[model samples]
Target: MFYGDKLTELRELNGLSRKDLADKLSVSEQAVWQYESDKVTPRIDVLNALRDLMEVDTSFLFEPNMVTRGVASEGHIAYRADDRKSRKKTRTELTYLRYVEAFVDYFEGFLTQEERSIDSLRSMTKQQADKIQYAGSQREQNLEIENLAEVSRNYLGIQSNRDLMYKIENSGVCVVERNLGQEIDAYSTISKSGRSYIVLGTHKKSAVCRNFDIAHELGHLLMHQHQNIELLTNEEYKEIELQANRFAGAFLLPGAEFACGFATLARKSNPDYYVDLKSQYLVSIAAMGHRAYDLGLLDYQEYRYFSGRMNTLHYRKLEPLDDKIVPIRPGKLRALMEFVLKSRLTSVDHIRSLFHVRPQFLINLFGIDQHFFDQFEHEKHSYYGGAKVIRMPGA
Candidate 1:
């Protein structure tokens, strides 16, 4: 009974193009229009494709003003936000102050807009102070940050390590370091469906640094998401950096428990004590030192001493600890790729271009070897053309 024009509207609303709709239908663009214009009634099978692809109730198509309700995920949650400060601000600790100042301004706009919109729609609230969510939807992705602040008891030699890093081994974020001239080694994007946050980091960073950077960005998401004002801005360099530091530390060492752990370790080791702690925590020596300082296990003098020694050891700077090619576990990134490929959301080339990384970067990530590209025609039957592998142009 419904016309194809109605189908077109739904498709557009759900962010689908005619070509995309056609691919899903296994038909031509013109045929799709015929059904919409009521020129011809599609068979039940084509009708089913319309229902599934558009995510609209086909039965409700003839109804008036029927908007497909996006099943409400948890509402947008933002942190005490601040704006980005001046880009010109030098990399000084105090510069972060300006960033926080501007952040206060930008954050308020988003919050006000959120309030007005949510009030118009049927909304529900979840009891959590802060959460990680996709940038587009601002919906919570990780629930652990809700208690990151209050969980630490700061008891004897113990800090409550709140906020969980759900070790999503099957999927993870990666930064794209290209063979090009200059580019930041990392990037972040919210999903179109508001389902997940995608972080692309170059492979140069070690797993620990990559882990910390991702957590740091997650901290920004949780802390500055819904603030009524701008957050640590360009001027508020120190505050922004401090927020990052606290977030990184909070996620990694945990406040109370890490402190207690440090105290217990420090008392036993004394001078060279952090060596034992470093090995135990599986964190960098610098991280160990900073965690000790945060837990009050080391006085300012002790902290200065340990920090200086670690720096001299070149642990955080130009030098690194023993390098071991730890086997890569398919993490959140890989999982997301699989979902995209299976769902036909976008092609593999589209994803690579969206992230602007080396094509080989993603393909090689989940045990997808690159050597097969040498002979696609002759090796069509080989793993290169296997169902498990999806080829994009750049890749």
Candidate 2:
């Protein structure tokens, strides 16, 4: 029997509507709806078209959706996208995230998941937020965010600004780099299976920008875990965005240390002076200047002059050392695959059979480059005979 839900999932995952699929199949929109509703099975040609378009095997339509069977929901997604985000785009992104979570869940079954501090961090952040109420004055909320940042920084064991992405991944969060379109920078969410994900965009962003994006999403993951972002008003959403920004600044640059340093080097409003500090802090000059102002290291007039000098120097977009420091990429998933494949625990064919998708589909879905899987092609032997389907508890 064909699974309509599978078709629906693929359609949405591809960011397509029933009408769009119907047009592709040269069928009526009602026909596509019926196929998705399981009221009617698609013809062989239509099925083949779907298999071609969705980049899945024909047998995928009949197989049980292992991805959705274990997972109940995608959970609340907190992203810093444009305010004019379309409903369709949001749906596509969330469904895409759900599929990624399902893939990660599959890979995690064979490995020992060490105890993580992410849960404790979230609990601590929530407790702090409750204590502060965050609904008080601006100064009060900023203080609360600063406290949360410090708490998270300590929990993640970030002594310096180095290896932030690695530390976050070590805390049991699955971070992935993906092209998140033009409007969005990054997003994070907790999956129904109790996994946290942070997706960073590969869109023309500098290394420091990506670091800030990660910290921003971390703020969302910790601070707004309970808020239903989809139901939030525009003003409410803006408030959270501001809070996340403040958290990012505080998290990246601790107030006391940064202020102490800024007082020595930042006597005047010179963007060039920040260039040297940028190398040490690994933060953009604009961000550092903003943090200085927030910390009262720069007076209003001085900060305004600094902003003018920054614009004059054209350091807003691509600053110095932007290209020198390589942007961090997520390696946990790649490392897992390496361990599994290199150890002969599994094969590429076995993975394909499990997912029932083409290699290109997996490549596109994971948002990793094409050449990543090519290296493992030499080890494409069948290991399914020895591989047991381990049924994990609560999975």
Candidate 3:
């Protein structure tokens, strides 16, 4: 039977409407609606057109379970979109995430069966907040954030900024970097199967900024998982963002250690004085300055002076050593692909066939270049009798 839900999902994934698909198919809008409503099955020509347009095999239309393998309710996504443009972007991102969840589900079948564990800070934060008779005070919230940061660090076994990204991946969070356009910075979402995803923008020039973006998304994953972010008012959204910022700050630069290090600085307001700390902590100059202010190491006047000086130097837009410091890239997905290829478990073409997408789609989705897939394509071979063999010359 034709799967109407799959057709609807693919159309929406591609950001198309009934009219749009109908126009593309040279049919009436009602015909497209009928196809999606399961009132009528599309003709073979239309089915082939859909297969080409959606980048899926024609047989996928008949497979009712293909798209629904890992699909949960759309309500599971907790995205940050404050404007119309951002809402549109969020829809596109959510669509991509559905595909990613499916991919992960398909890939997991090839791996060893190990129990995946995820720590939810939301429940912990709530329990602590209840124990403290929590009023919605900023100071109390900050204290809780600081405590959670410490707990997260300890739980993940992260010793320093160097191990932070690795710990996140090891904890089973999928991190991806892509060009999300200029409208948004980054976003995170959780799947019904407890899979966490953080998508970062690739356009961030500074490694410090990229790190901050990742940490911010991590904050959302840990603190606000399963929350309906779309219903938040602007003020409420701002508060959530502020909490995530504080989480990132505390996570990157812990309280006592960072304070001890900052106390050693010769001049508190000098941007150059923070260069070594920036190199060590992988935090932006602005963030370090704010940390100094927040910790009372720099008084209002000193912080204002430093802020003015940084503005005068125009370091906010592009900081020093940005080009030299390499930004962190995601490795979990790449490592999985490498393991599969190196182990001879599968080829790139086979993976593409499983996903029912083109090679370019995988390249864009996985944040990899063409050469990465091209190498596998060059080595692709057919299997016969459960083994790939080369015919030998007759002796």
How many residue pairs clash (N, CA or C atoms closer than 3 angstroms) in each of the candidate models, in the order given? 70, 0, 0
Q: Rank the candidates by TM-score, best first.
A: 2, 3, 1
- Pick the TM-score winner: 2
Error of 1 at 23 (Å): 37
lDDT tens per residue, model 1, 289-385: 6666665667798778776766666666532432542313223333334433454545545533443324443343323445432322221111111
Worst 10 residues of 1 by lDDT: 88-97
lDDT for 159 in candidate 1 is 24
Candidate number with greatest lDDT: 2
* Candidate 1 wrongly placed segments (more than 4 Å): 1-192, 198-200, 227-232, 264-272, 318-322, 325-330, 336-395
The residue ranges of model 3 lying beyond 4 angstroms of the native Cα positions read 1-65, 69-85, 120-126, 129-136, 376-395
lDDT by residue (146-239, candidate 2, tens digit) is 9989889988999867678778887888888776778888888887767788888778988888888989999888887778876888898888
Task: Give the residue spans of candidate 2 off by over 4 A.
Answer: 17-34, 43-46, 69-75, 84-88, 266-268, 376-395
lDDT of 3 by residue, 275-334 (tens): 899989999999999988887889999999999989998988877877789876777676
Q: After best superposition, candidate 3 residue 328: deviation in angstroms?
A: 1.7
- Report, for every candidate in turn, its global Cα lDDT versus the true structure: 0.41, 0.79, 0.72
